[model samples]
Target: MKERWVVVIGGGAAGMAAAVSAAEQARYLGVDCHITVIEKTHQVGSKIRISGGGKCNVTHVGTSAELLEKGFLRAAEQRFLRSALYAFSNNELRALLQQQGVATTEREDGKVFPVAGEASVVAEAFRTLLQRLKINCELHAPVQAIKVHGQQFHLITLHGDIVADAVIVATGGVSYRHTGTTGDGLRLARALGHTVVEPSAALSSIMVQPHSLVALAGAALRGVAAVARAGKLRAERQGDILFTHRGFSGPAMLSLSRDVANMQRSQREAVHLAADLYPQQLHDELEALLLQHSKKQGGQLVRKFLQVSPIGMLLLKSETMPYGTIPNAMVPLLMRQAALDDEVTFATLSREHRHQLVVTLKQFQLGTVHNVSLDAGEVSAGGVALSEVNPKSMESRLVPNLYFCGEVLDYVGEIGGYNLQAAFSTGWMAGKSAVNKLLTAL
Candidate 1:
């Protein structure tokens, strides 16, 4: 067999996996090959080092395949991601790491991290594996330009020009530019006859207006939020809402960031988030409950109705009843209206006032958020269009011997280890496909 050189760009999760997989495939086929990983940064897998707050969420712990797929919301259809995921599922990924002496543990929500609870360990394991395989690992080698002539790829880097029989571009997306993902893949794909979607922020925080939310900056509400655009509810997600100093963050807001980013780009419109602070009951049900509580209590203020902690009840729990998690902003707004006479109490509220108060309780306006930070997101949402790349192989349909995987691709999964899983699966597929295609051609 001929000696083929496979070059992988970026050196993040996807590039590292691709390089390793290609080397494994070459060794298995008894084919002579040189696989090199080109990283622009000082350290490869820098993002992995910082992921999951330095814990490195390697993959989702959905032991079952169905639950694992659900983590990939608003992404390429399962039809597209099916083969890669099934071939290298969550358990398989964990087992592969285990073989390398890196054990992982699952969290309450199914996010899997190293048992050691440090991302650097996972990166080190990969580094040790590459060293064992004698795969070339180059750092501080930024890709400046790329071109293809005949069947070979010419990759111009800060160091110099390096030609390869095949190239896997896994340069990631625009998020975390400090980690070296500066939308290099998108630009490179565009330059190579691929359609590049406009990149934006995903898993990011939004900037909200209205003084009420601004006041309760540290408040966190455990409930559901309905995203409304043009006065119509577009989507709804249930999770913990984190109130940030800038605006809104946490799982729910970050999950809806894709739609919010689209709205910002397409219509330049601000969307309203109708937060159900007490999502356990419907609006009418909550209204009736509040009215019933008001009637039962004789001249008692809404606040003094139950003996509960001041801030925790208002912000955290909604378990036993609507006693807590009422959102600090709504406490004053509804109380000021529900109060009657000099003594402001729930019992003093008339039927009409109680009904209005209940309505507000069911749907507390967290206010309108206009923008989500692009650079602050966990992942960037746009990249090389899927149609231009073969999902099964992670190879570019338009550019021969050129491939893409990970955040460089158009599909961006939600938080909670889905993105990492996709990176591994796609890189696995790309590595095998690239090696097989080149060897077969020879």
Candidate 2:
């Protein structure tokens, strides 16, 4: 049997998975093949090592349908990810990690992480798997360019040139340049006649125009419903939101940042983000409660009224506002926004004032969003267009024996474990497909 060479251009999550899957398939089929993973940085899985603040949210615990509905926002992405995600589901991933001696735990929010609680454990698990499989991994050797020469690929790297029978490019995205993902895969894909969509930030914090909310930095609201509106277009997300000194973050804000960023690029108008502090409460219900408060606690100081009255007690007992009466700090701000003074009592509260308070509470505007930081994005939103790749196998539609996966493909899942799971599944598909193609040719 003739020995064949397989090369993976990146050593991140997708590249590592591709290498492992290819090796497993080759061994199963008794193919004489050698696999090499070329990483430009000094380490492999740099992104995985620092993901989830070092805990490494490995994947979301759910079926493919649930993940598609919860994690993927766009219909096109859901359709493209259907096959790969179902083929290598979350349970399959967990089982593989468990087999490698890495136990995983699931959070209440459905994020899965290594029970060891160290991201290095997940990275090390892959390293161990690669070592056991005898796959050659070359670090600090970046591929400068890839050239096809009649049934072979010549990969020119910093160290030397290597020829391979098949190539998998999983260089990830341009965000996190410190991790060696400098959009090399997109460039590589473009050179091979694939369309590369312009890349931008996703799952990133939105920097808003300076506003009163800056004073409330570090304040977080639970069960908030946020909507990002630009022109006639709008994007909505529901979850907890954290106020930043300059902007907003947390699950809800990060989930909609990509759309906001794209809207900012397409329009000159400023994007406005509005939040409903109590999304579960109706406007009429809140107004009726306020009316009752005014009638019952007529003589109490306006500032102190909500603290001791039915409104506060009602909100406290509600399961949604788990943070305990809206962060005593925001009450004053809310009052100020309603044009009420500190000393005014509920007895003197005008109907106009009551209506203003309801408006402010029901539709609190964060501010005008100026930009979504690409450098700070957890994962970028664009790459080689999905239209140019085969969704079933993750192989390039125009190039034979050439494949793409991970952030290199044009799909950005929401925050949580969706993106990493996409990387793993597509990578496994690409690797398996490449080897199967080789076998067919042989």
Candidate 3:
């Protein structure tokens, strides 16, 4: 019998998982299979080392496969991740980590991280597992190009040419370029006659045109519903938002960035973001509350109440009240109709203007964003098309014995552990499936 050689490119979360899982499948089947992982960087798990601020978010605590699938943004992504997610579930990954002496903690929002609270610790565990499995690892050996010749794959690299019976391209998307994820997997896949989804920025910060926004650059809002309008797409997310020097960022911004970016790239749509600081309160309810607060805090300066938060310092700077003068509290600035002058107050203002204040608070416009920089994205969305790969096995439908896993695929998940979980799941399936198919044929 021929000794099976499986080559896995990239050694991030997916590549390592694939190598180990492939070896495990071989062992379970009692097949003599050799696995090799070729990493471009000096070390494996480069991305893993930096994830969750060095404390590796292992995966979401969602035990159900359906819930895991729902975390993905696109319908195709959600559907494609189904089989792989079920094959090696979050629970199974958690159990494997626990058995390896790593404890985990689940946050209230379901993000799971190592109890050791160190991403290095998680990376160490993977390295140890690879060693135990005897998987050959080649670091600092980047694959320059990949060519499929009949039943074998020839990977020309900086080190040397590596020929293997099976190959898994686990190189992640072009994000975190320092981590060596420079779309190598996409290039390799495209060379093998696969359709590559045009890559775009995801989880990136938006650049707002309004210059006055810089004043509230550090102001942050929590549990706010951020609704983004781009082209025909209207995406919404609820979380924390940080007003950046350029525009908006943080969880809420990142969550909708991919969708917004995609729309921006595809269609020349005017991208606008609006934040509702209080999602619990309705427009009418907010109006009443604003009036009540205004009446109570009437004696104080206008900038000293919730109205200030609604306007932030960003909107205040736009007003024509001197160059730096703040609206008077007793003046009831929100209740002013004509030209917001020094005369208007709650006592003399019309009811219509008072209601408009509620509208202002409920729809705090972030203004039109000019661009979502691809380089700024945390994860690059869109890679190898989902149609080109088998979701069940993570195998390339066009090329026999060829597999792909991780962000190289045309999928991007919302922030949390969803992306990592998908990578691990698909890699595990691809590894197991590659070896299983080989054994069956042999």
lDDT of candidate 2 over 314-417, digit per residue (tens) = 44235453444566677788788788998888789899988887888877778898789997889998999999889999888898899999999889998898
Across 272-331, the per-residue lDDT of candidate 3 in tens digits comes to 888765666777776675567557655543334434443222321244422122223412
Winner on lDDT (2 vs 3): 2
TM-score of each: 0.91, 0.95, 0.88
Q: Could you report the Cα RMSD, in angstroms, for every candidate shown?
A: 3.1, 2.1, 5.8
Best of the candidates, TM-score: 2
What's the C-alpha lDDT at position 366 in model 3? 71
lDDT of each: 0.78, 0.88, 0.80
**For model 2, which pairs clash?**
none
Over the full model, what C-alpha lDDT does candidate 2 score relative to the true structure?
A: 0.88
Question: Which is the winner by TM-score between candidate 2 and candidate 3?
Answer: 2
Estimate, for each residue in 1-442, the C-alpha lDDT of model 1 and write its tens digit. 5799999998888888898899999999989989999999998888989987899988886643563467766445455677778867889888889999999998887789999999998888888888989999889999988988888989999889999999999999999899999988788888888899899988888786664556667877665554546334366666777878778887888888877877767764567776655555566666666666666765666654423422212322245643244554545654554443335577567777667656655556767766788898989888888888887798899988899988898777777888888888888888888999998988
Best by lDDT: 2
**Evaluation by TM-score, superior candidate among 1 and 3:** 1
Better of 1 and 3 by lDDT: 3
